[model samples]
Target: MKKIFLLPLISSLLLFNCTPKETLDETFQKINSEVLANSKAYATLGEATSTIGHRLTGSENGAKAEEYTYDLLKSYGLDVKYFPFEVETWMRGDVEVQIGNLNKRNYEVYSAVSLAHSPVSADVDLEIVDMGNGLEADYAAKPGAVEGKIALVYIGILPGSPEGTSNLHRSEKTALATDNGAKGIIIINQVDGGVLLTGTASVTGGLIDIPAVCIGKEDGLALKEILKKSKKRAKITMTNTSDQIKARNVIATIKGSELSDEKIIVGGHLDSWDLATGAIDNGIGSFAVLDMARTFKALNLKPKRTIEFIMFMGEEQGLLGSRAYVDAALKDGSIDNIKYVMNQDMSGNPRGFNAGGQKGADGFFDKVGEHIKAIDSVAFTNQNSNSAGLHSDHQSFMIQGVPYTSPNSNLDRSIYGCYHSDCDDFDLVNEEHIRNNVRFSSMMLYALADTDTLPARKLNDAETKAFLEGNGLKLKLKIGGDWRWED
Candidate 1:
């Protein structure tokens, strides 16, 4: 009699458990259809690049881009909001360099560019000291030799790093150079054919109290050869203008139908370098986010958990916008509500998604990836991966013990010469690429939000520290002076 009574209850429980997955699978179909049929990601990217140009953090073009994105999100009639923050604006001025004796003060004028946040005027006259790769050990090897001299380092890691070794950020290299009392820093660009790259050498947004500049590979090598025969001295004259200005982050909210407290963040930064239109660097990723918001509104698709579509600013200047967002949320105790984060920086043509956490996230990502592939085997077959990398907005969320996601894209490497250069224009963008990203990413977002029980959980303070150490980042963090845990 007891077994007979329990049979009906067991069947009811099974039906209840399977119902949400069925609903989620069906909803995923609708989202993919809506995005594929009518996704304006490429068109909107074209418009944004043509109209506002490169959206620098504190420039007039930056303000225009902010307004454009804000108005576009406002059109959806969702709960759109703008979070503004102050950033120190950095801009370039006349830059000049020459090498040789003071009689002529002229050896050759190779193409050189100024790094951001350098001193207002650098009229330094000093001898050059080549520090290979600018690794920490290089500074330690020659104590008291770099003071009052220009330290020259390669912008990219040389071709000789061991298999298990990782290179530090360019700014971190700069920090090491500055700590050793170097009067200035000269970074050599890896791109051939006289391509000069300009980026912030200061790890933090603040100034480094030294002049930083980048020269081409050919020119840098020529200088090194000249140093071999005799002492090589040079003169550098540069002026960088800066001011404090307000920047904005645009956010659009779609409330959950059932579980209102649980939230997910879909984020991308809108700021880019002032050299070109930045069409591929960020416009594709961020405009795709904007199009996703439009698609959700057009289709009236409501999931079980809330979604926040965010456009950050000041990413080119060291992730100031995303850091501000995370700090505010933590201060107000709203960080507990967030369950997942999807960061789309420089993303294009999604082949799959990256599960950015420990091994526990693998099972959940495999289920979702397989289900999507089943819908369209030709497109999403064998595309997803369970991997992670640092140096994007995802780092802000990951450090807070949140699981994150990013597009596993197959980008072309030939055009890397255009990155941070004046050639990252609209010509590099593809129509099909942006559309594909929108369709696939929209499907993934909906599925994540609609699933009944998410597989990931937030780490406690101790657990978060353990995760960072386990990932083998403690040494890198210690070198960069970001280590918070004591021995």
Candidate 2:
């Protein structure tokens, strides 16, 4: 961290009588130095991945991971507790697919996997229909032809969209295809090479009516080319087990010196896909929260407002743990104590912080980013994004008029190929990335909690609705059937 000194800026530190600006600077430095020197995030993440394996919610491993995290937090001497929640959990089964040649000879279906939460035990020899991007117009083109055929489409927008074309999400694509009459759906992975990725196919996180699967980039292109030349068919057989299971949210609190009732929640989901160890997807984020809490205890640092370090389970299964947390908070009237939530979900290696609040929080985030850069210019710059995104624990907070933040970085693209695949193990994670996240985000959490003049606060229901509309999240909410606002 290079401390750029200006003549007038030196006067700024001394201007504050109680908590001087220098003290804040020193705190940031202390956090960085401690994290860079003795960060337990990597080691703990190693243990989690190696020992506990994948924490797929509803599975035994998921239960073990929950208890493991609970015990770990208790060992940290923090006030820790577990909030249990039930969710419909799905498991992967023997999924096999074969493509038929023009002569009807079955061939291998290379680099393919059934999409998560697909219907269990489906056996179908459905004819394949290439639907391009599987947009609404594409489905409209086929009309009745898709009623019994398997719809093939790109997992992303094909050849990029034209000007003013709004691309729907993959799940949305699946929903459209099924609703239009497709018996099955096959999405081509945008990622090149043979890396197979698995994510939810159902927008609501429940089992989709039809089986959906993802094919690797190379295979999908070859399949598409063959389909274009001659009529081909596919046979898919899959067996999956799903049941409602118990999950937990591990939570611990760092008591505030003042305004203890005002709370700031920092969390990431602990449960990840069963495909791999889930190191990068969330172990990085959740462990960052753990180490940050450790660093605070190690340095005996306490902020002015309470900080709850939470590890939510069942996020990949539709944010179940976070939803339960929010429900409990609302039921017990504890929701009012929450001032902000910083969700570090797959948002490691921070170039800056993203205030994904319901309303505009750029000015506040910009100030926070400046301070972070003054301490560690490499870790953070003037980058601040104000928007809301789904498929993370933060969404549970964002829809309820609460303010939220996530680490902003370009590093996300580098890992999309392995995000939910078997490649998402401990090896893909960078030590420095975890350390930097622990350092920078911990400072952000502390700053948000301590800053007496912070502009972010809980929004009213009307303001929340408007904020969602302003952020262009209304459509997404409506697509997921999460929109509560009624005209």
Best by the lDDT measure: 2
TM-score of each predicted structure versus truth: 0.89, 0.92
- Flag clash pairs in model 1: none
RMSD in Å for all candidates? 5.6, 7.0
Per-residue lDDT of 285 in model 1: 84
Best by TM-score: 2
lDDT of 2 at 291: 91
Clashing pairs in 2: none
Cα-lDDT of candidate 2: 0.84
Candidate 2: segments with Cα more than 4 A from true spot? 1-22, 102-104, 107-109, 160-166, 357-360, 410-412
lDDT of 1 by residue, 1-487 (tens): 9999999999999989877544656777877888778887887788889988999887899889999999988876767889999867677788887777545455666678888878878888788788877888778788867898989888777776545545667788888888899888888888887777877877656777888888888898777777778776667899888877789988999999888788988988888888788887788889989988888888887888999999999888767788789888999998989899988887877778887756677677678877677667666654666655566787777778888888887667755787787678888887877777787788888878888767577777788778878887677656545566784
